[model samples]
Target: MNATVLKFGGSSFRHTEDYHRVAGHIADRLATGEGKIVAVVSAMSGITDNLKEVMLNVNKKASPSNVDAALATGEMISACCLEAAISRLRIPVMSLNGYSLGIRTNSDFGRASIESVDPKQIMAALLEHDVIVAAGAQAIDQSGRLTFLGRNSSDLTAIVIASMLGEHACEIYSDVPGVYTADPYLVPGAQLIPELAYQTILQMSLHGAKVLHHRGVHYAEKHRVSIICKSLTSDGAITGTIVSGHGNARSVTVARDSPVFSCASLEECDSLCALLARHDINVLRLEDSHGVRVCIVSDIDFAQRLVSLADIGPVFIGLSNVVTELDSSGLLVHLVGDYDGAISLVRQIHEQMYPAVVSVPFGASV
Candidate 1:
C-alpha cells in the first residue's frame, strides 16, 4: 500500500481558520486517493513559548522533566483542535496522544528518544480511519512519564511514523515555500532549490538552515525516505524541495575571512560546551594552538547565550577583546551537485581567498 505522511508546523495551526485550511487540504488529497495520509501536527504558534514562560515563573531552575510537562501541552491542544477539524468533515479519524499509544521512551524528558513504538494498534486504526492525528513532540516513557522531543519535534514525529509505516514519502508543510540557498528573509535574491540530495539537506540543516530539522533529516536519510517540503498556502501543488536518496556526488566549498576568537581555560571550555548543548547548537570544530579556538554555526540566540556565559568571571577571562570581532553577517556559500563542480568551486574559492586554510572538516557529500 502507498502512504504519505503530512506534517504541519505551528504557524499553520495558529487559528481556527488555519485548521479549516488544513482540513480542506486533507480532504482534497483524500479525494485523490492519497492513501493513508497520517497527519502530525505541532502546537499553535506561541503556545510553547507561553508554556516556557509559565515554567520559568514557577521555578527559575526548571528541570528538564518540568519543561517537558509544560511543553507537551502545546501539542496536545493542537491534536485536539485538528481532530475536531477533521471530525467536522465527517471523516473517520483517530486522535492519539503519545501516552494513549505504547510509544515508550527514555527518561531524558525535554529531549527524550523513542525507545519503541507499538504500531500494531496505530496501524489497525489507520486502516479503518480516514486520518490519524498524532500529537507531535511527545512520547510516554516506560514508567508512564511524559517526555518531549526537542525543538521542531513535529518533523521528527512525521519521520518516525513514516519509517514505521514504510511510507514512500513524508511531506513537511511549513510557512516557507521551499528550501533556498539561504534564508530568503535574510538574503535578498535567494533562489529556491527545486531538488536536493538527502546529504545536501542534512548539511544545510546542520549549518543553520531552518527549513528542516536535523534529526528529522537524519532519520529520513537513514530510512531512505523521500521528503517534500512545501508551503501550506500553496494547495500542495507547487512542488518544493524534493529530497531523495540518490544524486550526483558533490562537494561543498565554503570560505570566510573573519578573525577567529580564541578562548582559554578549562572552565571556559566546559561552560561554553554546556551552554551550546542546552541550546542544541552545533559546533563545527574546536582547535587548540596557542589558545583555544572554537567554531560554531548556530542561531543568534545561541551566540547571545555564549556571550552571556563568557561575561561571568568564573569560566572565562582575558577574552573580552576577541568578542568584538563577532559578526552575524558571515556569508556561507554551499555548492551541491556534481563532485567535479564542487572541486572546481573549492579551487576557485581557495584562489580568491589566499588565507592559510586552518581547518577543513568534511560534511555531507551528495
Candidate 2:
C-alpha cells in the first residue's frame, strides 16, 4: 500500500467538534483504502499561548530548560486528544512522542533541528496500527532534552516523517483554502495560484506571505517531497498550493551597480542576516563601509529586507539614485544590462518632468 502523511494545524483541531470532524475525515479516507496514513498534529488552538502565559507568571525570565518543559504540554495534549478521538473509530491507533520514538534533535530549546528519526520503530508501529498520531513541533535532543520545533514546526515534522517513510506526498491542512497571489483578506482581488515552483513559494513566504513556514518548505524541497496545502474542514477538492521542485524556466540575470542599502549596528545586521537566511536569500557580497555594513543581493530576493532595514535604521547613503519612494517595494529593478530602449523611455520621462532629469546610469534597467 502507498503511504501518506497528513498534518493538522492547531486551528483545525481546536475543539471537540473539530476533532470529530477530523476523525470523520480520516475514517472516510481509511475506508477508501487510499494508503497507509500517518497523522501529525499540533496543539489545539490557544493552548501554546496559555502554556506560555503560565511560564511567564511563574517566572518572567524562564530558562530554556523550563520553557521547553512547559511548551511541550501543548503537543502532548494534542496527541492525546487525537489518539482518543481516533480510538472511537476502533482503528488500531498509536500515539508516539518525540522522546519515546528517539527522534533526536539539537540542543536548541524553542527551535530545535531534527538530528535523526528512528524509522525502524516508527515503521513497525505504522505497520501494526491503522493510524499513528505523533506529536508535532516537539523533539528530543541528542542529550535527551525536550525541544520545541519553533512556530509552524508541525509542518516540518510532517515533512520529515513523510521523507523518512518515502511517501509520495505530504498534505498540510490549514485554515486557508490554498495559496493566493496575495493575502486574500488584504487584497480581495488576489487570485489563487494553482501551481508554483518551490523557489517562488520561498520568495513569496520571504516577502510577507504567511501560507507555509520557510523551514518546512526547505525540508520538503530538499527531500523531494511534494506538498499540498489544503483546508482541513472541507472535503472541498484538493484546493491549496502545491509546492514542487525547481523546473526549467527562462533564466534572466540583471547586474547592477546601484547603491546598496545596509544596516549599521552589528546586532541589527545579524538579525537582518538571519531574516534573509530564513527566506533563503543569497547575499552576493558584503562589505563594511565606515562601520556600516552593505550587503549586495546577487541572487535571491532582498527587496523586502531592504525596506525593513530602511525603516529600522541605515538610510541609503550611496551613489545610487534615491528612488526609495518607488512603488516597487519588495521588488528589485535590475539596473545593469543592455537597455537602450529603457534609456530612451527614461529620456521621455525626463522630457515630461523637468528638474528631475531621469539618469539612466549608462546600463541601468530598473
Question: Where does candidate 2 clash, by residue pair?
Answer: none
Tens-digit lDDT track for model 1 on 293-334?
444444332344355546533322221110111012343444
Best by TM-score: 1
TM-score of 1: 0.74
Worst 10 residues of 2 by lDDT: 319-328
Per-residue CA lDDT of candidate 2, range 53-74, in tens? Answer: 8998999777876788788878
lDDT against the true structure, each candidate: 0.68, 0.65
How well does model 1 score by local distance difference test? 0.68
